[model samples]
Target: MKHGRNLPKLGRKAAHRDAMLSNMAASLILHHRIVTTKQKARALAPFVDRLIQTAKNGKKSLSARRLVARQLYSPEAVEKLFSDTAPKMSDREGGYVRIYRLGRRVGDGAETAVVTIGMATIKVDKKEKKEAKKHKGERPAGYDRTKDEEIFLEKAAAKSKTAEESAEEAKAS
Candidate 1:
């Protein structure tokens, strides 16, 4: 008998769910992308999209800002949404947020996902990528086994010498 129930409860009551969604929406608006659970990402996608739609429809009007402000947790997020995100999305229609499934969590085994603004581009530095590929399967830089062993031996010898000196002092006394 699950009929006409559009919104997911997300394991929280009405007020708590709204607060969590508001915080999550604010974070998503401030930072272009966020990593979260798959279910949360799914819930966040539509929530953020509606805010973007509101901003887009209102065209940065005072009422629109106030309306969006009511749903978002941060005023800065509201400003960014109205000034930056909304304008960028003006050319397009809905679907402002995009969710990408990122495997499962290691600890709790919950499914993970990456929620990102649809227009944002995630960039990886070419030099860093090249270095990573170049050093794949190789020891990290400045890792010298001989040097490490020497340092360990030196420390152990120092400890032994201290112990011997303390023993000699005890015997002399």
Candidate 2:
């Protein structure tokens, strides 16, 4: 009996859903990628693709620009859409967005995913090219694990221990 149902409600009313989708579309244009729930990403993919297609289809027309601008309210997003994203994607016909599932959320267990423009790229190390190709779903090859907070925590702990020992020696003296 589940027929003729097309739209995903996303637990929001019509106006709210429209606003949220519009903002999400703008954010995706600005950042090139965004983390969101799988369902939301699915819904947003086609919406954003159509916007990109519109921009691509009519890059020079003022009316086309105005039409896309009406959908995405942000000025920067519209500018990027017209200038960078649209031209970058003009070679392709469609399918502008890609969604990758990233397991479930911790608190609610909802399925999460990342949606990115298909052309987004990151610098990768030449040595890890094979490994990076094997695990394309993860980050780019140049990711720095040394910058992680665990290293900072270890350094802080060592400093704190040394400080405690120096304080103990001072107290004894």
Instruction: Summarize candidate 1's per-residue lDDT along 1-173 as a digit string, tens digits.
Output: 87886998889998999999999999988989999999989888888988999999999489988889899979999989988999999888888888888999999999999899988867689999999999898987788899989999999999999999999999999
| Reference-based TM-score of each model | 0.69, 0.70
Tens digit of per-residue lDDT, candidate 2, span 1-173: 77885889999997899899999999999999899999999999989988999889898999899999888989899999999999988678888899989999999999999989989744477879987677878866787877877889899999999999999999999
For model 2, the local distance difference test gives 0.90
- Report the poorest 10 consecutive residues by lDDT, candidate 2: 118-127
Query: Model 2 Cα displacement at 2 (Å)?
Result: 20
Q: Which 10 successive residues of model 1 have the least lDDT summed?
A: 114-123
lDDT values for all models: 0.90, 0.90
The runs of at least 3 residues in candidate 2 whose Cα sits more than 4 Å from the true structure, single-residue gaps closed, are 1-5, 121-124, 130-173
Candidate 2 clashing pairs?
A: none
What TM-score does prediction 2 earn? Answer: 0.70
Counting only residues 3 or more apart in sequence or on different chains, how many pairs clash (N, Cα, C under 3 Å) in candidate 2?
0
Runs in model 1 deviating more than 4 A are 1-5, 124-173
